[model samples]
Target: MRERNVVSAQTQLLSTVAPSQSPSFDPDLGVITPPSNGMARSAFARPVAPRARWRRRYLACLVLIDFVTALGASRTVVALLDEADAGFWDQRVLGGAVSAFALVTNLVVPLMWMTVLVAAGAYDRRALGRGTEELKRVARANVAMAATVSFLALGFKKDLSRATVAAIILTLLLYTLVTRALARVVLRRIRRVSQRASQKVLLVGRLSDAMAVHEVVTRNPGAGLRPIAIHLPHHPRPGERVTAPVPVYVGWDLVPLVQQLGADTIAVCGPASLESYELRKLAWQLEGTGLDLVVVPQVTDVTGPRIHVRPIEGLPLLNVEEPTISGLSLLVKSMLDRVTALVGLVLLSPLLVGIAVAIKLTDPGPVMFRQTRIGHEGRAFKVWKFRTMYTDAEQRLEALRHRNESDGLLFKIKDDPRVTPIGRHLRGLSLDELPQLINVLKGEMSLVGPRPLPTEDDDYRGDVRRRLLVRPGITGLWQISGRSDLTWEDAVRLDLHYVDNWSLVYDLGILWRTASVVLARRGAY
Candidate 1:
């Protein structure tokens, strides 16, 4: 009788709410407020989702940053040119056009740049604060701005200086990228701390699928998804226990449940019980609720660049492109690797010589250590590094094998007795691996790829052998991620991921991150 009354009251409350009108909740008063125009009260109105709020805030921040960056860049360029040329601003180009040009540079340019960025979708919520898409858009927008300026200058016969145009564009691009990156760092830190700053996700699916999604969102807090609850399609059997980190619910009536739990995002993962028609109906139910529905596809590991969505009739088809292991891009990567390796070696020769001298003076062993390691396509090559271990290190390997702190084929010891005092410092700073730049120059290795393993650890087979498809590297995803601290499985996974997603841009990002990791000495022995 009590349950029926409760249901009746809920039904009456919902019936009173108009289809188009959403009720507003007062958290302090714990009641739903009617529309300001004196409309009927609603029980279904929810506050704006935290995810949406944060996204709006972030987007506004980006717009402000872009505008400020563009303005600053323009002003800086104008100031520098004026100072350098002495009469740069005063000079008449095309009959006393100095004032007009000044107006364009000071006011018109920043607005035009912002317009280009908006049209390029740099400030789109989906692109903002995630991935390289935002950065790429900003770069393209700058290019477009440059082209537009050149076209206007040519068409109107305006005496626009190419140097000034290039300077403004370059400055804007650099400033925007740096400011956006710093903004992302700050936003990520905030999201990591404040649960309300992230999307409150309600997971709906089979237990296993839900758990998988849960693990992913939990692992990446920067994704800004906080799982609030799990909703199963069916109830557990008698005496059966269902264990979950979040609160669990069972039923088809998800609207009320979602509102009650304050979940703004519904993630449907591997919907076994929810068929096509039912899923469509769920979408209909959520139409005016201001809630976001995210469907998790089974496909994994592939990134956005590789995946293309094609819609035929109403069915969406996913087309996955083959990894770019070879071709023009790989050729470019190879060229870059060799060129960078050459430059690095030339610049660091003094430091390298100093390390070599120090090792010889203290360790009483050969300065350079070479080991037979597997390289690209199972080719055996002698990997070079500054010797970090004593001359008798090989002999003591068997005795220390039992004390190996690493998992899988790799052998590592945090406090190995074989490492000389100077060697330990060199290893900690990753200076010992500097000589591999020689291998990179020789085409035997890459500046960024899988770490080359010694002959004894060569157990490549199946998908694992894919790591050998590319030249090994001095530093890679594995090195920057955790190095010796990562488990063998994790190391192999990272290596394979790098191999599968190899790109010049990805390599550059890893190289950039590697500097910070090395400086921190994280996971290094």
Candidate 2:
């Protein structure tokens, strides 16, 4: 009777708590369970089964789309081959034997392409909403498929148009990537409307650790894991309510709780909270349940490519590969940066001239803004920008310091008196930074890298100074993420992430996202 009274009172308190704050609850150790029916429409509950079915059907549609895309690509390639190499087709008529073989090859190519996609796990539900990794897997599968097809033809001594096959595979790869990108955009919109489609997660950890992981997951909705409930087996204050947005459950029996909540994922944050025996028991209980067990390491800012899990003697050991700091690849990146900058300057000369003319006519000051900035290896360089502030803006900075909106090491104000009338619009669209293309050409920066800090503000130490290993960029991860809207810690984390994992493909992805962010004018000044 006492235990029942405790459960009832805790449930009542939870019901009264505001939705914005985390709920606090008293631990109920006895058989005083929450009402089963109430679990269906709790603030965190959703129709999990229906959403799962819908996703399966959605993935099926994507598979059909890929199948059609492969067929179309093959036929298009054959037609191009016909036009480019007419003699090859002409030779087919000699007994019509070659023509029959050509027809067979065309039909087989698309089928093979579909098989490769399936083998790649491109249509897997888990891979659907997650970013880049899905696309990278698709690329890898197509490349491997192409190589396999080539080897088979060589080994069998089969006569075939290798160029046409290569072209078709390339087209298929591109089509798959483009369609998947569109699907992700649509999926995000659907997820916003039908939250049930998001991966439901059961968070099991300390209150502090749960909250930290919660912040990351909530911030990146595109990453797809949604915490529906939190399990604080070791809540510091048993009788005190924990402040959380989701339902707070006390004690661990994670398997039973997960089954009751219909959670698709169980996220265990931090290593210290769970014992080896408990984790092993939980893993055994989770077998055949179809629930994904995600153990999030305390280490932050690590990406998928760096992390590898190797199983030895029934134990999974995680290996994090160290990033290479220098190589011939860096030389190639530099060459490409200079070439791209040279081309951009020549093409945008008229726009640059117009901006200079506008600045001269609008404000009686120099058309360019040159400031000393810390670059590679902490070297100082005079970075150039299209002037967007009044001449006395520097002198006016001290008075507006109190009104700064940014946090931790950065100063930003939504509305600053120092900005000239014309400057506001320019900064809004990021046109003020166009002059930095010259910096790229001058070898002080790359086309894509960490954002450079002002020389006067440089106080980097230890790991923070790693950003100086490569040339700073005109635009980068920080630019696309939030610009002036991001906190100082977030900016540092992103810069450090880039420093640890810099690749040409990553640079291109950043450049692509930069275009979208710029056009949307999101998180701009």
Candidate 3:
């Protein structure tokens, strides 16, 4: 496993590419480097640098984490080794049997387990880069290993204590499950902490198709794609954002397309979805070019759990499962939210009071800030929060616009004068957003959904704005990923994704993710 040399000292990021370094056409491949040492080589080079080395490092880190957890958990079995239960007696008897078993089991099981991952095609370089999918793979691999080991032990008449074995199994499984997930999440933030993940890829389709692909990928920055140019077999319609800012090329321009864009991947999701022959040719052209050819299917709002890709005789088949949401399922969410939110409100009441008091003392203002944010079906209602700004912050908004750094309808600044001293701390760790439990109680909001947006122009927001289809939440996908630091486009994308894929099980995951995000606070500002 390659480890990205983590730069230990605090340092500021410098731009890797010059402003004028724009490629002549969108990249067919090779624009972003693997995240290296968390350093931006572009900061010093000609805007283009070899970065496969960086990817190697990031992948190595993930492998190292999984290895440590599995190896470390194996050591914990030493504790259960203490002074002996039956079937597994003294050091020599137990030791010999267990040690022999351990050696065989450990060696065979891990490899077998890892083999399952390989069989499942779980450890593909690209798949491992994405967090959620990799998590499922890790869990699946561990479960398979446990089953195999248990069966083997039983057959050999050397079965250890069920409790000890179970503990060992649980520890091994949990460690892999957790550490793999952690490593993926942490690597993303740490690796891309300083530099943006900008992939140079070529768009293969009509103008509308190219534009749609660009929009979708842009909305998911964590996906790590940056289309530098476009490829059109023929002229696309005028007024289509076919080449917005990025250059577009014709079929005859393949050589320039590769050279000018420094493209590392050819993203085919356009009319080519209908063009098998050209798609094949495009794949052939990209071969040996060190550029990946990725074909994006029409699948949307679907997670790995519901989608299975199988290849039979070189024909790839994609299977999308029907949604599991049912009436009883929704009830699970409502009940869970109500119980959890209610208990949380009561348990954290003292902390809430402390926040309110601090806010009042800092700004001589209402301890709670209330503002109408759009909720389900565009219902307007005030969401509550411990005051994180001066009482006059809104009234003084006009003056702060010049300082606004957030790129979207939302306003955000890392160090806003409007934020009280206490507010900054609350905002950092997210204590400031706690008062929305009241909104949940009132049925004006949900315990989890998109962050409700505030609007005043219309009688009610529209469905495009209808993200209000679900009740708003106190913390959500947006909150966990980044509160204010996210681009406006990404904020809505997550909200819509959440709305499209809402489930009780999904909500539980969101809440868990929210805890980790809070501690890391990568996007707090």
- Candidate closest to the true structure, highest TM-score: 2
CA shift at 221, candidate 3, in angstroms? 5.9
Q: Write the per-residue lDDT of candidate 3 for residues 290-311, one digit (tens) a residue.
A: 6677877777657646789899
Superposed Cα deviation of residue 105, candidate 1 (Å): 3.0
Worst lDDT 10-window in candidate 2:
41-50
**Tens digits of lDDT, candidate 2, 274-320:** 88777876666666667778888877877757888899998888888
- Model 3 residue 124 lDDT score: 71
| Structural similarity to truth (TM-score) of each candidate | 0.84, 0.86, 0.71
TM-score of 1: 0.84
Off by over 4 Å in 2: 1-51, 83-107, 151-157, 192-196, 238-240, 455-458, 461-463
lDDT of 1 by residue, 1-525 (tens): 543443344334444555665544322222233344443224454334434677787888888888889889999998998789987766756469878777887779989999999889898766777758879998899999998899988999988778888899999999999998899878778887775467789898987899899987886687778997777776666655556666555643566557656678888988484788778877777767878888888876667578899999988888888888999998998999899999999999999999999998886769999999999999999989999998999999999988999877789999999999999999999999999999999999998999998754358867789889899998999998789999988898889888878888898899998998999999989
lDDT of 2: 0.78
> Least accurate stretch of 10 residues (summed lDDT) in model 1?
25-34
Off by over 4 Å in 1: 1-53, 92-102, 147-159, 193-196, 237-239, 271-273, 455-458
lDDT scores of the candidates, listed in order: 0.81, 0.78, 0.65
Cα shift from native, residue 504, model 1 (Å): 1.4
